[model samples]
Target: MTDGDEQVSGPAGGSGAQPADPPVTGLAAPNGGASPRRRGPLWTALALVLALLACGVPGVLLLGLVGDAAGRSAVGRKDDPATAAARRLGVRMTAQLDRQASALLGGDRTGFLAVAESAARPDLTRRYAALRALRVTVWRPVADGAPAAVDGRPGEWRLAVTVDYCFVAPDCTPSTVEIGTRWRLVGEEPRLVAVEESQAKPAGTRPWEVSDLAVAVGERTLVATTPALRAKLPRLLAQAEAAAKVADRYAVSGTPPDRYLVFYAGQAEWQRWYGGGRPKWTAGYAVGVGGGHHDVVLNAQSVSPSGMGELLRHELAHAASLPAEGYSDRSNWWLVEGLAEYAGADGQPVNRHEGLAEVRKLVRGGWDGRFDSLAPADDATDDRVGGAYGVGYLAVRHLVDRYGEQRVLDFFRAVVHEHRSLDDAADQVFGDPWPALHDECVDYLRAIAG
Candidate 1:
């Protein structure tokens, strides 16, 4: 197995090598359309991973907004002429920026041209066209970091804008990105002069930039630049199909809509998408976009041969069960991930067994973490996180082993579709509360591991 840093603590795990932290950002929006709220630990870890890459600082969300610019004036103190001019210009630019955003969302090339300078029209048109082709919609273009008046030119200003990209499907969650923009006064109006879009890909590159090639196997679409890599599509498609079947057996609301787009790339491309070098143990990730589709990327360059299929199944399970709208709470991390591992365990991959063993070692080694709180430990030692996976798998494995797969599946369905807490779901499905079930898992593990 390719084992540089990929192991399971959360999202990514294996044996011998430490598990890489999985990308927490791309899974389907847990909460589809609910009011915005703090995401659970899964997303919190993903944000940390992204921040680690972009700024070499961990714990910040992806491309942290430069800084809140609303209160600070860029030009000078409140009494300065430059400040007044900048304030007026800032208001006008904000309006024009809104118009520009509308044009981009509507795919109105002329509308974009009307707002952009002549020198920028062609590029803007091309960019808008590409975004439209990708089926990306910009919901809001809010100014984030403060706007600054250029030192010597009263006609120039720079603003940091964060645009949220809506999914083509109403059920999918939107992705937000921070971009730095420069606006210049042309003739009587302000127009876009330049955009330092951090999220913008090179020409001809797709959003993931893993590959430009594409193919379809059943409901899955595989994209890559190499024929050899593309050949692997059949295997992934098979795994996805199996994952769906396994997931359906346990599903409550039926399978989610499947975009089924998979991308094959090296570690470099994977890191690029997250905006930084991922944890050395990182291997691959699945990102859920609009339209009930998930874009899966494999670190083709890193995952071991023995692990490739297991990784695919695990991620596919996430794709299969992702809710169309809001998110699951942090307390249910074990349920969300335990089920993924369960669905993917039919192959008898060693990683699962190793993770299970890791938990035993932790218990023997004096660790006291509980399965209920098992999540990706972005900062914890590998052993602790690996134990999380180990114990998580055991918890689900015990439920299925004792309660029969149907009741456990029902439990998952209730938590996801019916929005039941883990305790509620357990009580409803098994007539036992969470504490009892947790105790059962403890007993089962002790009996077997002893």
Candidate 2:
């Protein structure tokens, strides 16, 4: 149950005494032919006459040319039969999607399944049930671009569909993900046959799509666990709700998500679900779905009940503060991880003694005293990673001590959410340039290290 075992997907990093999980894995045209003709002597003579007239053209010939131009314009204005058919199919698919969305929102399983092919219905049924269990409030799937015709498949088409969904009602913002879908025309009706990963750009798999879930809805949280963990739902839900309250205190940007969605992943799910390939040491992580909404995933087998609270607080803080558009600059890793560490350590010690010891070690080893340099390397040992998390916590604590919590939060929002430059954000929030602020933080670290 090490504190640093949790990771956050996107720009912001993790917090606590345990090793940090690795960064969240970010998820991301034609030819022709021709022919020739032959002509007789009379036709050749007529063609020669026409060619001569066209060079300086007779008035009637010019008028004929104008008429031909007008005809070409008319043809260009009208869609070809193939194009017209595709348009009609697009309309039908749009209507079908609307109906499916309505059915999902209204909990009409039959209606939702009406447009699905028999082969796809079983998987869709499972998905619908999972969404219902998680209390999904919104499920809108819109065609991203025009449906593309599948090669050599006359009645079948492929489309990129973007789906928007939300678990909590009214106050919850919809998070979006894209899927590649295959559809076929069954007597002029569009039938969904498959929903799959897009080869061009892959999206993270939702928890419900991974396995059967047992859900527990709390006042400020929704915990979805596997059937094996159903008996512990009450305990997990309670821990999440408590953590949400602590995290709410740091939600300075705006109202926190209507309900913090948490997923408790079983052993198999822990590896395959929600942006996979996390280090084995990772006990939990938070991933942004879209629209400023992030969902937390806990490795059910790895994290203990007692350790869940700190991890939840750290992740929920990310859900509360990370922008809809995630940050990419790794230089801001310290502030990103530090803020979470700060919020997570609320009412608890800042892991001070261990953090200071690490800082002292770095200083004595000819460190440059740059906070940016303190983040753990990708292959860093657990002890080294743990030390990085410790130093990050102390750095944030220093900010809170010098400037009040609100000011620190304002600075974080400006840089991370608002995407302002560090110098500009620091000067705006703290009345000093970033370099000055950086030097001050370094001085504070050195003093504490000593």
Candidate 3:
């Protein structure tokens, strides 16, 4: 990941590595579609993940609009009939929820008994309503067993009485929708477990049409272009698997079936997609994500012998881990880069990209430093790309080996739970300051690099 100004406009140049590399502009986007579709949902489901990603970041959902959820007036409304319907369902669900919630909170035995008894009767919520007219389904009493008696203890409780609202907006288009719900009793009153409601158009997988070597991952779905590139998919999967085995700190689902989502971007859209007209970096990336979906996209031109899977791996790693750059985390730069690079390989050293060696050599001091652990990554404010991976990777490697795999996981978890300062963690765990520890790492790398 080169800096913004490091654009290679002319001929591609590089160290004589096996697979050449692209002049990368730190940021890129997956090439999926806003294509028209039929059936289930393509963009809609994608929107959920995207929305979640956008959460706590700037400008998601609202796009440019404004409103507040969990407030009286909701902002960022996508008020299409489907969304409105979902909102309506949310409202009714909240009402039924409120009743049980009241019973639970007030500890009103009489009120609770009335609601609980009604809850037990067959189809009680909409007992009198017609299935066709109400369009409601009640699958109450879900515990992987029979219904339970509702009491404060040792009793079965059901809270899910689902309702689907379908009223066409002034547009007069008959909008169809559905929502399913199931609730379980925590003590006596039922609590919501599943509430799914959305509008969707089953869409096609979006891959950059021009590229023959992009990667994407989902449920049993790994799509790329050519057989040569496809061959690399297993390696990505393998790397994910091995890394997951080493520690449970990097992915969501244990890497068993990567919740990873891979997308391919065609050559045409590459210029416009990410990095703006030139190239740029993006926020909201997972530098050390444990799981969920990740996208690996590539351009057609990237398959040339000059191209390294670095960008694919970088972005994918960011998808898996995180890709915070600039002011976000001046301290953790080295760490995020090294972990991604380590995870980027196809498992076999023979298949590893040679450019990586260039990086490794640089860290080792080209026969200079004593080879302890590279150098401390300069604060992110410096904008120097070299130190981030050099220092951080060595530190991570040392920590992983020194503490045992489990402790390394514990360290990462500590970061998540006690995410304050590296120096603090060092002080707390190793009884040292971060800067002092980093110097030791540099000396260590220098020693090893020799």
Candidate 4:
């Protein structure tokens, strides 16, 4: 299935994790982190994260960056002209970004234009003017990169530096974006010349370009859609709030995210924003982005009225549970997906009984792939992918039945937050090895489906 922002891959043959929603590269660059370790007590890290959030660090300390180019005060050793120049250029670029961020956040088109190149300022101004809410932080400023000679200019050089930013809005999360800009020698000091966004625009399409979006902000959701779908906002908001509440219940031990950002558009708009990799059947997806927010994108054209809540909840489950850094181990794809389904399974796309029946049919048809071996539904048939969802849901359901809800939640924390191997985490909760846990899950599915 095609990837959505949160990728609402269908029940089968689609992204099971949304598989994080189909790998559609968007405005934000992917957050980087080490994979969950196979060994070590991961709960130690979980404890620290929880402790930080408990200290009300969610609003202020949302991100911890490694470098700040804009704020660099270091002066290299004497006689180092290149370092001095880089530092000088870095300061100018930082100021430009600060102005850009301030203008975007304040909805001050004129202010934003002051820092932008005249050519792009009009478009930027229009986009910012239409934007409802925006927050920008330059986590890593443009710095330290060396300058290269421009293609045609003899004396002039260009330094291309990537600025890492966290952009949050009413209908967007604190999604990480890497904006590249070239600083060129205009007169004396290096000045901003060209800027490049990571995501390429699909021809003739952008959310801001969609002229008549009706936007509304709920207590825990931000809904934006065309006038045709505007009436559906109230119900969507209610369901999102309910889903957030449910997700919070499971995530009380960790950081409960802030208000979710839901962008409702048709398939075309969805594809454009998602940078085009979504499967045809994908309804929508909610991306668990960094900086304590999630990005929910839904294709209103594809989702049936009854299925919207379930799909949103399914994505919300991912938003609530998955770490901001993203899930690393593909081997636990089933659990990753199953936990989402189990959490959001108020029953619409498919209820427990229906899903079980479907799994039973698949087992009868000789399906043999273990949950651990199931990868994202990149190439598999839809039926094969859907079976993964069913089996995953049942697996999580069995765990919940056996260990209770909190333990199941803790298991996720150990695996995702703590970065422990699935086996190691299962060992902590079940007190036995992972093989035994797998067998029990299989047995549970059989008993329920037999």
lDDT of each: 0.54, 0.66, 0.34, 0.57
Candidate 3 per-residue lDDT, tens place, 158-237, comes to 22222211111111111122223444434323344433222121111122212233343333334343434555556554
- TM-scores of the models, in the given order? 0.59, 0.78, 0.39, 0.72
Q: Write the residue-wise lDDT of candidate 1 on 74-161 in tens digits.
A: 3364423323333344555666777776776777778866876777766666566545544554356666533564545544668776
lDDT preference between candidates 2 and 4, better one: 2
Among residues 3 or more apart in sequence or in different chains, the pairs in candidate 2 whose N, CA or C atoms overlap within 3 Å are 4-18, 28-201
Report the lDDT tens digits of candidate 2 across residue range 1-450. 212333442111234222222222221100011111122432343344345544655442211111122234335476443333444445566667778878988999999999899999988898889989988887766665456656566556776766777786744567777777789866546799987742221126777875788999989999988888899899888988998998887775767777788998888887777646665446666666666666788777767666677778877877776665555556677787787767766657543333455556666766777876776654554555555666677777888898888999999889877878988998899897788778888787777767
Q: Which stretches of candidate 2 lie over 4 Å from their true place?
A: 1-76, 152-155, 197-203, 351-367, 446-450
Higher-lDDT candidate of 1 and 2? 2
Top TM-score model: 2
Number of the predicted model whose lDDT against the real structure is largest: 2
* Candidate 4, residue 376: how far the Cα is off, in Å: 5.4
With candidate 2 superimposed using the best TM-score fit, by how many Å does residue 383's alpha carbon deviate from the native? Answer: 1.3
Structural RMSD, model 2: 11.6
Question: How high a TM-score does candidate 2 get?
Answer: 0.78
Q: Score candidate 2 by lDDT.
A: 0.66
Report the C-alpha lDDT of model 4 over 1-450, residue by residue, as the tens digit: 323223344642223553342222223332222222322233343334345545656442212121243223343534233333333444454556555656666666677667655665555555555453323333333433434434455433344444343434334333443345555444443455555444521111335433346666666666677667779878877877777776666552376666666778765577666464666546666554445445677777776776666677777777677665565566666777788777767533334433565577666777663777754455665566666677888888888878988888888888866779878988887787888888888887767667
